[model samples]
Target: MPLIEIKHEGLHKYRVIKGNDQYVVEQKARVQLQQWDEMWNKKQEAERKKIEREKAAIEKVQKKAMAEQQTQDAIDELEMIDNTLIYTLEIDDRIDWDSLKDLSDFKDPKPIAPNKPLYSSEPQKESYKPKYKLWDKILPSIKQKKIDESMKVYEEALDIWKNETEKINSKYEKEVDEFKERLKNWEEEKESFEREQKEKNDAIEKRKEQYLSGESESIIDYCDMVLSNSNYPDYFPQEFDIDYNSQNKTLIVEYILPDISDLPTLKGVKYIATKDEYKESYLSETVVKKMYDKLLYDITLRTIHELYEADAISAIDSIVFNGWVNTLNKATGKKQDICILSIQTNKEEFLEINLKLVDSKSCFKNFKGIGSSKLFSLTPIAPILKINREDSRFVDAYNVTGKVDEDTNLAAMDWQDFEHLIRELFEKEFNTSGGEVKITRASKDGGVDAVAFDPDPIRGGKIVIQAKRYTNVVGVSAVRDLYGTVMNEGATKGILVSTADFGPDAYNFAKDKPLTLLNGNNLLHLLHKHGHKAKIDLKEAKLIMKEK
Candidate 1:
């Protein structure tokens, strides 16, 4: 029977009223659902924020402790130097002036021990004599006594000077020995420190190189390798995608969820005490729906948990999970894959969740997930736009290197690579045009680069395509040649693509005809729109061409 709304309000009211004297069921159901939603919705926002705050605080504390430990290690190594040599310069008074200057200049020091103190004689002291200059000549005995006394005073002063000089020299030599020992130890420690730091830095650099060179395979490949050997429930298709955003240090996983039909409907078997027998009964639809919703939630959480746990490198700080399903579309009566839920969660945030006790649906809502209106509905789910990946492996064509001159740029991609890239591009484009694009043989194919076979009866036939890795702006001649090739081959259309922009005449010529001209920018945009990235510089390409 076709269902239709009653045209009259009175009739509709009557129909709902006696609609089995169960008119209150729908309204009561709505009230119950509303109560359940309210129970979770009005939760204090501060409670959710506490989780983030705690994680940040813990990370901050750990980092601070690590920095402190490094600082202490360095300080301990430096403290091994002689404290007095470091704190005082007492050796300055003992060093030879000549050698002292050289030592300060970082040159070899040949300090010589002195038998006497280093002093300059400014003037001789004059002594008061009792007019004895001539008297001493007349009196030989007095003159002899005066000479002996003068010798005695001189010897006494020399003895004192020698002792002081010896002591100073002895201390200078000791200080020199101590300084050398400390310097040797310090140099050794410094070298060790630098070597250790270099080793650490080299390890990090190796990892970085592996990351960029696709050797590490990023988290996506890592998880795939791990999960491929992982044990799981039977008939569970572990179809998923892993994309790492280097900028954000995040791993986005698009997991294909199983259909609700696969979920267990019976919660548990119960005993009928009255009859003393066990009753095997199926769960109510509402209970089954709740269990299924929770199962999906559990699966999402489990996936994130597995990735985080298996990742020893912790390359990904957080994961964005997109759980998708294939549901039948009423319009086309075909099953279409669509994402039913999306969640962005950090490791700390997810590990804190207790799946067994928490209301899975409410928790999913708290974590900000988008799903279908009803958990068990047959309606199709829309995918989250941000998590979608743009397949751009084709852009790698411009990055080809090796066996080519260093002066060459993007345009220097070997002719074979250029031809392959063009074939892939036109194949994608012509696929929409109802044609199969095939590249001609490398040697000679009647001056044709490629040909597209379109099966559509109207506006569909063989389309000739030519790829020009030109550094200079393509002139009208290339466009004219493509058109001639199309006509010669009895094709329906023609396209000429170049790495450089097309000249005005070239565009104008193709504008009025069945031929199409794709310049460098147009080609790039087409590649990017279809999830490819490429780099092209006309001036650089031109310079490289000139060099070649």
Candidate 2:
């Protein structure tokens, strides 16, 4: 319809179509305007949705921090409970209340008074509902005004829409900028995480090779890492220390024993619905001790088992285990770390025993490795082999500063590096042996340092090499131990290389044995014969070492 000025519905002027064809022009213009309005509204709605999603993303990141804090708090509570031994306990033997009246410390038990609840009922959850818009009434009214060309109320309505739309667009633009910043941060964080992961994997691979070739400090650090990640029962603390001796190829494990005094004796408490009270049930002290003893024994076995199962442990030929408890001695009124149990078992011997079928009480006895009789009694026992801190693998050296110069001579290189250098020298010498020779981890393993299998078909057998960096004359004791190791391992021949000359007694002992002793001169010659330059000067080595 065509607009014509006329009084209608309290308006001084209203739009009307005079003829049939004139109304078509007005309707077409109305359609075009309506399309423009609808397109703009769609654009605004799309941006509103985008803004909402970004807000949700920000909220999720905030919630993650809160969740992590909650998890850490729960773990702390469990640790405290474990240390205090407040787990459920059972009491079978009742104490007579009247008999303790004469004692100054005697007192009757009192029921605990209940305190207020931590909080009111948890926050209620409500379903979400979208807002209702009056677009039906408002849209039609605005279209009629625009079509009539009133320009007064029509322009006012447009101004309001434009202003509101602009406000929303401004808000959405700000949100988008914030979202973009967050996205950049997330990308940077991800890249950094990937870099860190790559570094960690590289370190693991390098350490794996070092560990397999008789560098076991990596194994100790690996075990600690695994245990640190392990989820122990709430309240239980896992603490341990380890060292390796390459000579006999033995791992020395010093583990902290858990306090069992607070172990729960009660099986459970039954809530009497009729009386509105709980009936406590407790186990006898003897029963509690027996349970704790079994638990302690199980823990000891599990620790050793986890280490043995690790693929990284290549050279641990045997283990010397010790569990100590830190407590105050009533008699001395001094804190002491009392070694409750100590056992030594070779890898060959330990692998033959089955843990499932063996009782914890009889495990030590069956292995013939127990050195102490008072596990539960807490009697202290001296460790047969003490940990050599100097033996710590360079790769896992913690709290160490100032890099050690790798190019330095034998006197300056640490024991692990010295052993590694020797392995490299020998590996080069036996490169044509047709098989890879591996060094056993630095541990007390009789006297074998590295093992090589010479496959000449006729001379195909195990060959052992011992690297002795001693500045003094190689003694008969070392040669004898090497010979013993060769016999124990059933090797065809053994070689012992030293940085110093062997005594007459060492040569006498090796002359009849299936062993060859290489002095400092011979070792250098062999290394040089294999296209490697190396020299051992005992006097110079001693002077350099003593400078420390």
Candidate 3:
């Protein structure tokens, strides 16, 4: 009898029993293997958990470091903004006209060649070799049968190969045609691109010529391009309107300044690893206010310097920069736009100052720029001069004062004549200080009845005038419209003149706004002061209207 041999892991054992039964031994080995497997699995699970905890700890540390880096970056950004004027001194403010052109040349797309099928040779038939054996001479018919079968199979394979080759050739022809079509489309696209590029280059050249010719509109456009190309932080509004006065070669810029609230209040961030939380610290209100004031001063001086330096064509002799802010009025709880700072300086005078060495606010004051001591207060200040927008809506005005007398009730006058009469009165009012007033087209003036161009640099600018020849009292709606028009037109002030008195709400609405509400009495006083006499008899005019 053979001896029973049992192997268990590294141990070998031979056992002799009454019967050679391996079932019991196999069962014992299986139980031992399961126990070892359980132990190994537990060990692997413990190691995996340890790795996960370590990974999580590392990720938390990385996150805390990243948060700290972001806080520092924000602080650095604020510091950069504080030195805006100084940093800009190193930059070249002039516009390189050539750089504005599309300098990238057209590149022909890579041609895709037709995928020709690989040349496949026709299948050749193999020659049949007769099998030789001792009995082959006696069995020639069997060998012949085998040779015929081989020839038939070879013929069938040759026919199949011919068909496949034909299909491949046909596909190759179609691919060639498609390639030609694609090439034609590419050619047309290239032609169109070249034409467009040529047209664009021509337009740029024309604009350059116009800008160099000292054309007022073209100069304004060039200045706008120069300003638009400037790089600023994302928080900056960077919105501005530019106007050029060719007569005086002065460029007027109405720039939108960022409010104090627009800046980042966060000073730093700290991470608590135990709590797994980040705590942020913020700048105090006093520091924020100081930053706001310094930033405004920097912007004012920086803008003036940029325009002046970029005036390579000598198109700009002087610059009038008005810094406006759009912010919520805490008192009224509504949006308000007000000019916070204004500076008018010639290029010669402004360029002489070394911006890197001087303090921003002090330099601004040295130039006699007007602003409140604390710019964060949002105090409204008058500009030295404002951009006079050329409005095509203004039509020539006829003398309405020449046709009016004391008895000529303004309330009874024609609505169109009343509008012209208001223009004449204002013309007379501003004429003493070299101001001119023009009446806009009737019904098409876009809510503007008249516009006063007052040349008084200190207090004069574009004044929007709306004339309401109402026999009844004027409501606040008209006053609100005047305010909106002033903002839309970028005017320094708005004057609402009515034949009758304004309601108390109308006056209240105009309060704290750059609006002047002239009731019947005020209108009469203005008329008398301008050496013109007119009467605003609303009650008499109402009775006369009933008769009609």
Candidate 4:
């Protein structure tokens, strides 16, 4: 029935006796309590063990659930990619510049009065009047004396209250003045902001009017805004350059596309219970390639459609989209950008088709887009037309070839001298075809080291050249900048020559983009070809620079 019963005495001990055996009570009670304590300890230990087991089981289940959630997320991402074009169709591509204006009024400061001091209200004059009783009449002298004392005390109290009231009024007046100053400052700031807002709105209106009038630069700027406002997945690169031709009302867009390697590869994540680890599955190569091709096609068509739909002013009749990708070249182990697709579609033809019902790849084919059938392979193709180059930043150039010799180390030459030397050599090379090279002014080059105009119709046009005289290797950034210059200048080609050498990435980026990169060896060969020789010693150049 009961294991043990305990009795309490004073603080000295608890009588944890088991049974009433009066002869051997002490020894039998001790033994029974010892057994009972051991049994209680075992029960507590069993409870702790059960809790640990449940905790471990719950953790395992949570891990598996997390893995399942990850798998579902990956699947959702893939679905979004598959419907990229379809999703974009629902968005209104036009920009509402009015809604973007900041018209919120400034909040005015509320007037806060000072807390008034608890000053006693003016004492009533009649309350201090002395009472005249019958006994006071019998003692007229005493009563008159009392009345005089009371009047003196009342005058003294009134004087003290007047002083306290003055101090409180002074404090209240000071607080009011301080609040007035703060309000004045706030009003000044609000006025200045209102003026700025008015100017901003005026500028926006002017730009809108220019865009409506079909101004060349204004049209390009508006198109840029349209593209910037378009939403895309975070994985996509939103970098692009635009050029508009007013005569035919055509816009050319050079957009940087994300590489296939940059896309998410995990098809699903699975939790392996036996190993207690997560395993990820990936899409097959063939499936990825097919999806990549379709995506490229979707992007090509979607870009053109958006621009056409957003052209509310009817200034643009057609758009040309050239999709370019920056990636590492496996063959050369260098980074380069290749134009994977180019498509031109007019407003009339593009608006006639129901985009939601058409397959992206088939629609692109119907419009005769330029690209390889298998786009994942990163094949290069020529654009139907190039942006026109009409830069006016070029100034009258000076000559520097009269100062060069066989002993001249180009790596140690002045930067300005190096640019002129490059210009002279190119001049000699292009002279055979009646082309001339001109070096831009040193202070106003605007990212253009030199400019060359070739007279040959088939192989010649405005070519932009940049010179880099570096003791270290030229990286991909310089090469990428050259490509941007080529697009901005509207040149037929771009050339980058360095005195030291180029990094692997620089070489990679120059591929297929009408760009030329000449390393130290190539520079030496070009000089030798022109019956002149120059050394490119980077180590000596560094030493000279350090000494200077």
Candidate 5:
């Protein structure tokens, strides 16, 4: 059963409240109720607006869908009509050749020509002229007159021949006399020429005797005396050591000099000699050797100049190598190594000499070496170093630490420069495409030594890079760690760089993964590919690593 509820009544004394206070309480309560009602109305209005907006959005989507469907339906109906037309055309194959034939021309027709002559005709006649008097008709009388004239002419010719014979005899006698005089003059001239030649031979023989007997202090002195007597003072002293057993007498003077550097001016000197001596001199060993050396030097210089002229710097080493080899071949009785060394030294000297040749010209300016040695050393790092400093990612990677070795401190400095150069090359080749690169020293624990970002804008995302400057082979574990990092970072690719070669397992593991491994040889190739050269040798690098 439901419990019965009892109502309690208040005392009548409590009903004595102020009239204004009751009205104020009632008004305050009414205001609160009105506020709540206004709030509710606002909420309802907002909800209604939201519903209307949703309905409008749905209508917009529906209209767009309907428009798209209408376009598709139009396309489909057009396609169906086209198919029906094609079917109807395909079924209609009947021909109407009878209708196409012309009714006016059904029979073969004959060819007719206009009535006219093919050619104009007229009576033909030859235009001819006849001679009145032929030579045979007039010759009989003329022959007699000619015979009489011939007899007279023969008599005159005989008289003239007798006179002419006497005059020709006299003229022949005078010519013979003149010829004899000319012969005598020629004989005198010949004697003079012979005497002069004999004197020249005597002088050359004396000079030769003086050279052979060591009477002259030096061959150069004799040559200078000989040349000083003539116009040219800068004559090449003959090399007299070589003996030639020729029918004609030959004078050979040996000029002793340390090197061929001073041979330029000497090469231009001319010598005046008798024909016989000149012919005999060609067979002399001294002449042959001098000519051969001069020729060789000239050819080598020409080839080198041609290569330089063609702007072929890569061929310089090959030129040097071939030049050294040829020089060694010519250097008989000399030590091979010494000859090679001399050739190398001479090559360097030749470079300067060539420069001097150009420098002699008034318009030519002085040229420096362009630091080829330094550039060559840095070549192996060029591919790794970005030419544009702004594009280099590892520009701040390795700081210039303090000197490593005092004795080879320059080498240490070079190494530092090379390190920076390598970093620059890597930045250019690997990170120039708006990719990010981070370089840091490997921690004691040996995780990732460096990280690089390779972004693919079209596909979206970045790649990870790990560089290791190890002297030994990079192991598989490093590659594995890089792969893991790549996976963790959600990268599309990974790269591992090492100064040394990569281990077999490293490559095998990276084969399937989107990983690129650059080892020592590859690194060198890349450097060379981009015009970077390795200044330090492998042995030197190994030694430095060992020392470290």
Candidate 6:
């Protein structure tokens, strides 16, 4: 007989002599293996279902227990209420008995008995009477005693009321203390329940881990076997060296590439190398220069975008500060200016670059000059400008006279001279139409400063003016006060002139509130409109509102 072997999906058999019996044995072994696999799967499924049913039963029991606890809490609250009502009733009963005692003392006939003997012998003689008649003297004393007794009774009633109130308060305090203690105990019990639940969950998790351990062990074995025979390169790059030549001040990087040729190249990988200078060790200038050059060359070799993606560049301006001269050339050079290239990325980016480099210098210089003392000196001053010649908006020219020293000479400003400049400017800008202008001092008595009433009959109306010389932020409160003054003075429109800039909040408050806020800048513009240069820039004032 020749050697023979028979193989099946689940079993194998070998025979030294060739025979058909080996094939039949292998087939029977395959059927037994299939049955074993089916039985193992069914056992695992039944175990999972049992665990789920047990968890549902535990949850249902917990819910029932919580419901019972709530019911018990309600019954306890009702008992507490009943005890409080009983205490109140007992206090009321004691008060009633005290009131009855006070009434009995008033109605008693014993005090009248001593007076009766004197009245019974009154007919005997006038000489027999006591020095003071008992009826007259004793009756007054008795009446006074009754009054005093009544007051004492009233005081006793008040005392009882106070005591009862205190007793009720004490009861409430005791109840509150008990409630707090109960709450603390309830919280502790709830925590204990939670801890027990967590322990149970942990136990279930441990059981699941044990149940899965065999399958996990088999899968790990299979994975190890597959990986050992798999065709893949496991080699990777380990280290790299950056070398700099001192003689020529040149930089060179020697990096080991991965042995796997299929991987892509890493272009912007950062390599940080440190060179320490100790007190005992001295480095030559040539070495220092070489190191500086190496740092610059490495930093400049890669663009900002590549360095950013690779996380190689730390601070955005690190290249600029480390290698100042090379970075400047690269930034401003015609052929390879990385700064301009960075700018070409976007318009907003270009603006930011310009602002950081050039415009910020002036602002920084200004800020540095404005130290602690001089920071607040730039107070805004708003000068009232008028519209024309013969304008009644200002104080009367003849009434606004001044004395020249002690001499008998009078100095005055005519309305024509004051109004001529304003009228000419208004004519050039607007039209030759004239307007009546009125100027008056603003009063705390609800009156405006300057009211410019148009001369045109069809459009003539009042324009209220309020000039504020403030060193702080003009708030909404001031605007509200001005609006009230305008409404009271019967003015249709209002103008608020301030020497300082309005805070954004103040500006928002004034919107559509029938008021126009003219700050230092606006005041200057108005002056310029009237053909007069503003003597001040009120916008530079140290206003109360500083941007956060």
Winner by TM-score? 4
233-289, model 5: which lDDT tens digit per residue? 132222111111122222221112112322221112122232211111112445434
Models sorted by TM-score, best on top: 4, 3, 2, 1, 5, 6
lDDT of 4 by residue, 1-548 (tens): 22344532322235544445554666666675666677667877888999998987887899899999999999998888888788778888887878766677877754565675677788777888888889888998989987998888788889888888888888878887897887778777787667656645665676677777777767777777888787777878767768888788889998878789877767998888778899999999888888888888877887888888888889888888999998899899987878988888888988999988898888988888888888898998888876654446555655666677777889999888888889989999999987878777665443888889885646676688999988999998888778766655556789999997889867855665688999899999998898887788899999999999
Candidates arranged by lDDT, highest first:
3, 4, 1, 2, 5, 6
Q: TM-score: which is higher, 2 or 3?
A: 3
What would the per-residue lDDT of candidate 1 be over residues 1-548, giving only the tens digit for each residue? Answer: 22222223322221221233344555655555555455545554555788778876676566555545645553443232112122222112211213212122223343433343354332222431223588798999998888777767666666766777777778777777777777776666665555544533453344344534543233455555444444444645566656677666787787777777665443334444345444444557786676566667766766666676666665778788888777677689987776778888877787687654565567778877777657667444554435533333222233222232324344656677777777777777778855666676664443577777665545665577888888888887787667656544445588888888888877766764678888778877776666666677777766766788
Residue 374 of model 1: what lDDT? 73
Candidate 3 vs candidate 5: the TM-score winner is 3
Model 3 whole-model lDDT (C-alpha atoms): 0.81
The clash tally of candidate 6 reads 7
List the candidate 3 regions with Cα displacement exceeding 4 Å: 1-38, 110-184, 392-548
- What TM-score goes with each of the models? 0.34, 0.39, 0.58, 0.68, 0.25, 0.22
Which structure among the candidates has the greatest lDDT? 3
lDDT of 2 at 503: 98
Cα lDDT of model 3 by residue, 1-548, tens digit: 32333433423333333234567656655665566567767877999999999998998989799888979897898788777878788999998889777767679874698766896777676543445565656788876776788778778877888888889988898898889999888887787677656645665776778778877757877777787777788878887878888888889999989988898778888888888888888889999999889989988888888888898888888899999999998889988779999988988988899888889999989889999999999999998888666677889888788888978998999888889888888887898887889899888544899999885646776788999888998887788667656655556799998888889978866776688988889888888887878787778999988999
Per-residue error for 73 in candidate 2, Å, reads 21
RMSD of 5: 50.5
Model 4 clash tally?
A: 4
Q: RMSD in Å for candidate 3, one decimal?
A: 17.8
lDDT value, candidate 4, whole model = 0.80
User: What are the clashing pairs of model 4?
Assistant: 335-508, 335-509, 336-508, 336-509
